[model samples]
Target: MVRIAIDAMGGDLGPRATVRGTVEALAANAELQVRLYGPREALESEFSRLPKRLGADAERLDIVHASSVIAQDMKPSSALRARRDSSLSMMLDEVASGQAAAGVSAGNTGALMALSRRALGTVAGIPRPAISTAVPTQQGGRCYMLDMGANIDASAQRLVEFALMGEVMARRVDGLARPRIALLNVGVEATKGTASVRHADALLKEMANINYVGFVEGDGLFSGTADVVVCDGFVGNIVLKASEGLARMLIERVQATFAAHWGSRVVSLLARPALLRLRRQLDPVRYNGASLLGLSGIVVKSHGRADALGFACAIARAVQEVRIDLPRHLEHELGQRAATAPVALDRRGSGVSPCAKTDDFNS
Candidate 1:
């Protein structure tokens, strides 16, 4: 069984929603073992009420007491440094100690990233860790988008590395072998966007590691043009928020329209199945969280406003990631690429450059 350490004190709803979610996830997947980390008395009190509210499977749950709790408004680094006994810190400690396969939190993202880097470290040769999110496409497929908010500013080389990592994750986690990758740009043309996008485009086109399907505009994100989309965190965050906002708006509009009158109520009854299907497709809860990749240990971050179902889904995702040995697979792939790729040269002519010697060698 894959063990997941959860930050029971992090989210807005506190232990109630988180504990409820834990119960729900346990019920859904019997093989999952959750170690709830938070204030001892609070968690125990909540657990006591779960048997009557959620059921007797509460026995399967484990609790690790954390005296201190980090607030959402607190600075991530300060919170982590000052409150060493916070729930998030304790959860990460479990992951680092190998007591838990992964850590799941609906806590402050900045704190999570800082704590993760400090605790687990990053994969070799990776400049910054990235947050990879799975976005549902119109073709009933899911496209993986990376650098969601990990690194707001990135270089062309960083984007290229993110693409490679994203491709590996898409295949390993989503079971998509040879997933098509596209560089997210303003236009579909290779010449589109600023210098960063252009440089990334050139590098992607030349890289033989993954399937580089050229450029894709923002509009094509939901159209399923590519299985993996790469971009800097700034742009990726915008795309993520836009998609979320649109989904929420559509759902709200449908709900308001259906409540207008008797005629619409009849129409709503007939369309309930279709609406539910649509909700499930775009539901943030279903894909409730994203993984912070390139870190040595797994860290899954969920929405701050996520309810019990969303938290449950995040737990499930963490289990899947651990079961698949995500970090080990990434390390192997990245190490292999680093080994095969030519080493970087200094400004002085210490050795023959691969770019310059290629034609001469072929001749």
Candidate 2:
């Protein structure tokens, strides 16, 4: 049985949403166990509200006591230092200490990243963790996008690491054997993007393992041309939010259009099934988890405002990662990539310059 740690008090609804989600996950997957962390009395109040439909299944869940909560606005580094016993901190500690295989939380993004790095450390050969999640594409399939607001200004080398981690996620979680990757840029031309992206692009193309496609613009994000899109956190976050908002707006518009006039209402009734399908296809709740890839252990970040069903999706994602042993796969992939990829230290002895040779790929 795979056990996952959950921060019951992490999100907006605290234990209310988290507990229901855990129950739902336990009902859906028999092999799953959840260790919920939060204030005992508060969590008990939420537990008492669990639906009777999930009776014996509640046995799969256990709540551990935590003393405090971290505020959403707290600085990431400060949150890490201020509260070792916070629900978020304890949840991460469980996964790091081997008590759980993975951890899920809907807490503050900055604090989660800070605490996770402090607890689990980065996977071998990865400099930092990058947030990644699968987004719906135009071709009826989905593609992974990375650096979705973890590090706002990742270096060229860090972007390469994001690409590598994104590839691993696409393979391990999404079941893609050779997920094509693309760098997010202004245009497809080599000279179109910033120097860092151009540099990372050169390195990616040389990797025999990655199916490195050329650059993809903002419009190509959901074009279904690439299986994984890489970018700095700043751009990735904007695109992610914009895409989600746009999907919601589009779905609302469609719904309104169908209900506007008598004739349209009749047509809508005729196409209700397809419209429902479209609504489900564009629902943000369907994609609730954003993985912090490059951590030594699995950590899933659910949307802060997610409810029961959405939180259940995040729990499901954590379960999937644990079942696949994503960390082990990523570590092994890194070892192989690092072995072939040359690493030259900078003058300050700080980082590996993957693009050391101007003709590294062309050579």
Candidate 3:
């Protein structure tokens, strides 16, 4: 059985959402075993309300007591120093110790990132992990976007790293053999973006291993123009948040319009199936898991506010990663590239050129 460690006390909803989500995942996947970490009493109380189906599935769950919980607004450094016994940290410890195949947390993103790196370490040559998730496109396809709030200021070399990692995600998760990579910039022109982006673009163009497709503007993200889009955490976070907010808004507006009058309500009934399909497709909760890529082990970050269903989706992502042994594939790819064409670096042995530090984007 594939065992997954969960941070039951990490999210805004605490054990209520996480325990239920764990039960849901257990019910869905018969081969799954969960090593849930949190206050044993609270977790048991939450599990006390489960139906027979979940109760049966709970047989595979093993609750390990964790005294501390990581707060949503907790600083990463403080969480590391003071909350070592936190559910998040304990869950990662299980993964690091080979007690679990992967780890899942609906906790403080910063804390999860920091603790995960500390516990699991990083793939060889990866300075840090990148937050990545698949975002749907207008053509009914999905694109992998990365650096989604991990590093606020990614240097040119970091952007290249995001590209390589994102490319691997697309290939492994989405089964794209030659995932096209792009740099998100103000314009598609070679001269329009900040120095970091331009430098990364030039470097990517020279790498035959990557299918680097020059540049794409924000609009290109949903246009199905690229398979993997790389950007700094600042920009990636904005894009992801904006897209999710817009999708939620659009879905609500459609529902409101349909419920406005009796005639529309009748039409809505006729279109119920289509609307449900659309909602399923557009709901941000459906794609609630963001992978902390470039780590030695698989770690999935669930949205802090995710409900049981959403958190289950995060668990599902972890299960998928485990089934495929994602990190090994990434290590293989990185090794191949390092042997052939290593990333370009300046005299300082960094991805940035002298002008990159002054670039408005990185700054």
- Report lDDT per candidate: 0.78, 0.80, 0.81
Compose the digit string of candidate 2's lDDT tens values, residues 1-363: 999999988778777888888888899999998899999999888777665756788788888999998887777756746858899999998998999999999888888887777788767657567888888888687878888887777677788888888888888778888888889999999989899999888878777778889799997778899999999988888888887788889988988898898899898889889988787678753456888898889999888777887789999999889889898988888767776665511112212222121111100
Please give the lDDT score for candidate 3.
0.81
Candidate 1 lDDT tens digits, 1-363: 778899998777888878888888989987878889998899889878765564555556788889888778676546545667889899999999999899999887777877777788766546577888788788677788888876677678778778878888888988987899998888888778978878888877776758889889987777898998988887888778878888889897997799687899988889889888778676643356788888888999877777888888888888888989898988888767767764320112211111111111000
TM-score of each: 0.89, 0.91, 0.91
lDDT of 2: 0.80
What is candidate 3's lDDT per residue for 73-169, written digit by digit as tens?
7777666576578888889999999889999998888878877777887775577568988787876888888888888888888888789888888
Name the lDDT value of residue 178 in candidate 2. Answer: 89
Q: Where does candidate 3 have its weakest 10-residue lDDT segment?
A: 354-363
Each candidate's clash count: 0, 0, 0
